[model samples]
Target: MTYSPATQDQLLAIRVNAGIADLAASERFSAAEPDMVEAIVEGIGAFAAGEWAPLNRVGDLEGAKLENGVVRLPGGFAEAYADYVAQGWNAIAGPAEFGGQGLPFTLACNVLENLGTANMAFSLLPMLSVGAIEALEHHGSEAQKAAYLPKLVSGEWSGTMNLTEPQAGSDLGALRTAATPIESGEHAGKYRIAGQKIFITFGEHDLAENIIHLVLARLPDAPEGSRGISLFLVPKYHVNDDGSLGPKNDVRCVSLEHKLGINASPTCVMSYGDNGECIGELVGAENRGLMAMFTMMNNARINVGNQGVQIGERATQAALAYARERVQSARAGSPDKTPVAIIEHPDVRRMLLRMKALTEGARALLYYTAGQVDRGTLGDEAADRRGDVLVPLIKAWGTDVGVEVASLGVQVHGGMGFIEETGAAQHYRDVRIAPIYEGTNGIQAADLVMRKLGLENGAVFAALMADIARDATSDEPTLAALANDCAAVGEWMRDTASLDDRLAGSVPFCTMSAVAVAGWQLLRQLRAVESGEAPGLAAAKRASVRFFLDRLVAEAAGLKASAMAGAEPLYALTSEQLAG
Candidate 1:
């Protein structure tokens, strides 16, 4: 399906119910006065079809070429990027007071997913910029905002987060980047940032006039480890007061690394202050770099989750296309004279269903989380309370599906999926980083367990469970069946304890939580579809949810078993035992 248009009657139903409509409705949700949803929809659709969609294959096939110390993107990127900017897409969810469209993130999430689905590599620049925007907006001085926000929002320039160094993989505590105060003269109060950042996405690029780097640096008297780190806005090229560009900053893109996927996006190794004059203005208070970066990290993590959803959707579309055209052996009951489309085979259908179910389910989960974020942003105090509880859960659970669902896509494509030419392999390659980057899935799990689990002293989770139970008690057999599964899984999680147990089984726990939460989201989506008796959409929602709970919900048993298997046994085992 090209674009699923929500009928006017359905829109009216949303107005009547006055409930949530997922993150993509952030603009609709936030606008105090009603406006045309079609405008946002048409705007995003045009960007997707005209700009982003046409670039995916080109990016994958052409990739990025490393020449001399710079990475050159495919030929059409700059033009497509210009188109995106011209359409005002970069500022779609930006602050209106600062030249943005003044829309909420949920609306941005919708646009972002389509971009990712079309071209993830190209889409990543804006994703990182979003994080940079959040950091600067929340923590940057008013002067800094005035200097940078307009350019960044207007897409005249791009932004990136710079935290990882050579030694700092997942562990930020090991960061060796340092920022020493300037001794004297022209640049007073500023610091010289001297460090090498690895795996810096969009660290250096030609798409924008300048790249604003949000660098984490340590002051001269700063302590060791993460505590001493501080945030700084170090631009690649200094900006003149008239909004003109000036001298290049001390920072430079030393080189770009060859990667398995997202080749269209430049991942660079950058060295700041090699000339002993890389100027950086500190953000917020001293020793608050990590705190500031976390906002970007948190936002990017959720966006990455959406990236996963987008990839899964793309793969599903590709696989469906392949299955329809590729002929294979006939099924047992079919006539033996001629071959049939692979989709006609039971196994192929099963795989397609699995992919469809997983992709749809993931979309629902991520979209619901975005809805929660919007609710927190625009909804009153009572609604904000619940949104607060869902953030980490959204981040953790959403990313897990990206990896899992993409893998399912690969499986459906069979051996052809392994080859790069088919494009299916690229989805798998790109998605591999989702779980690892933006704070590894492990860290997401740890956050969910430590922070989210205790939100409102766990009353929030408890209330959600109670609501599930209430729904299950209804005369509707389908919901009653769902309630049974929900109760079983909830009990398992509630009864479990110990970080060892949690860690040992964290991946599975993440998946299970994703399934349950997504099921809940599907129910809401079904309600949205059903409110106006949009049967096809409602049927699709029900089928997707049923497929998940029936086939995937049982995986909770495995998760529970693993969660209960504390690290004690593994720790107690001798090295010899591990060797065996």
Candidate 2:
């Protein structure tokens, strides 16, 4: 199926309904006029469809190759990346003082959705760069920002986050990378970083002139565990005093992993200071690397959530297209009649609607979260708190839905879906990593229940529930009921006596929260439709909301029950019994 970007009307409808347009118009984003935002969205959509979509298959087929410590991307990748940068797409939401266009992040989210939908693997390069940009913007020294921000914002030099190591995946406390302070010479006060970082996305890609790595390493004499870690700005090539590239640093791409999907994006094992000369400057204060890295990780979590929405949308579109063309047996009630397109089959229709409902629901929640991020910048403490609360939900639930929708897409294709030629399986493979990428969904759930719940002495979570409750009082009955159920679940979470109980049901609790939040967003969209917004799409919007409430929202109750079941039964099975 040919890819289709979200219509301008649809995008505007979401932005307006979510209040993102108003937020953009505020002092925090005075430069982001609605017309300009629309124009930018239109331009990015066109570029994504024209330049990026066609390369998805080629990237998957050819993948990336590693040779002589350098990584080579698939054909057309470099050209596409160059076009992406030259057009200033990379600077859409960047710091205005550092060569960025200074647009609202909401618009950036839309552009990212379009790009990710076109080609997830190819889209990852810029995605990681944005995270790196956020970290440096928040923590880098003035000199460091001046040296790297322009190139990074301009896309002349890409950026990466080097966190995961051979011995550490999610446990930053267990990392062993070393960063010794240099006391003399031109690089005095800098640290010589030496370590092996694995699973570094775009770590060694040849898409740009240079790559900036935000590495996490422990300083000598520092305390043990994550508190001792510090962030460093490590460049692949050393920079001269005049801002020109110098000799290669003691950093190399030791190898690339052969992954199940996203073959076009190189996942490298990076070696730093192998020869003991890889100099890096500190970002933020010393012995606070994990805190600094969290800035990037939080940003990345949201982008990864958007990836879920993007892949789900793409997969659903493809499935719908296939269903409309693939002929099968006659409709259930008319077996003697002529065979019709699979779309005519009730079951097939159900699957397609499931995909549509999940994809749109996820999109609504993600877009709303992006709006909260924009509002948070304006010193809206509530919005900032809300953004933090929603991060895990957006990442975990969105990606889980993305995976589920992609799987349903494959099911809709039947035997043909299993064939690589059909491309349905590729969506499944590509989306499979999102849940595990930023932080595993399991980790996201744990964070949601353990950490975020404690914010403001639980007042933050209560306010969230209150907001949903207020919205649930709408005339729509199902929406109201779902909202009430969500509130009840929240109450149970608050009253639960044991952390073990919460942990036991953390995943389900997160899922229930996600469904309830998506339902709230859908309710808002339905109201917008009733008010004649996107008149032509109103009927479809209503159907989607109904489908979501009836089909998906019903799962919330069962999830709540499972959450309340506690950890006893979960631990009932011993290791040997589980193996049996």
The number of clashing residue pairs in each candidate reads 0, 0
- Residue pairs whose backbone atoms clash in candidate 2: none
Per-model TM against the reference: 0.90, 0.98
Best by TM-score: 2
TM-score of 1: 0.90
lDDT of each: 0.72, 0.87
Error of 2 at 565 (Å): 0.7
Write candidate 1's Cα lDDT for 1-580 as tens digits: 2322223322332332223344334554455234544466556656776667777777877777667655678877889888888888888778777899766666577677778877788889999988888889889999899999998888888999998888778788788888888778877888888989999898887788889999988888788888998999999888887878889899888887888778888889999988988999999888999999988887787789888777777777778887898887776696575888888888878777777777776676665566556666665554555555455555666656666667766776788878777778878888777777788778877665566555676666556545655654453344444445444444445466665665665565555555666665555555666675555566665676567656765554345556556678777868998888
* lDDT tens readout by residue for model 2, 286-331: 9998888999999899999999999998999999999999998888
What is the TM-score of candidate 2?
0.98
Q: Candidate 2 local accuracy as lDDT?
A: 0.87
| CA error at residue 246 for candidate 1, angstroms | 1.6
lDDT of candidate 2 at residue 430, scale 0 to 100:
92
- What's the C-alpha lDDT at position 505 in model 1? 56
CA lDDT of 317 in candidate 2?
90
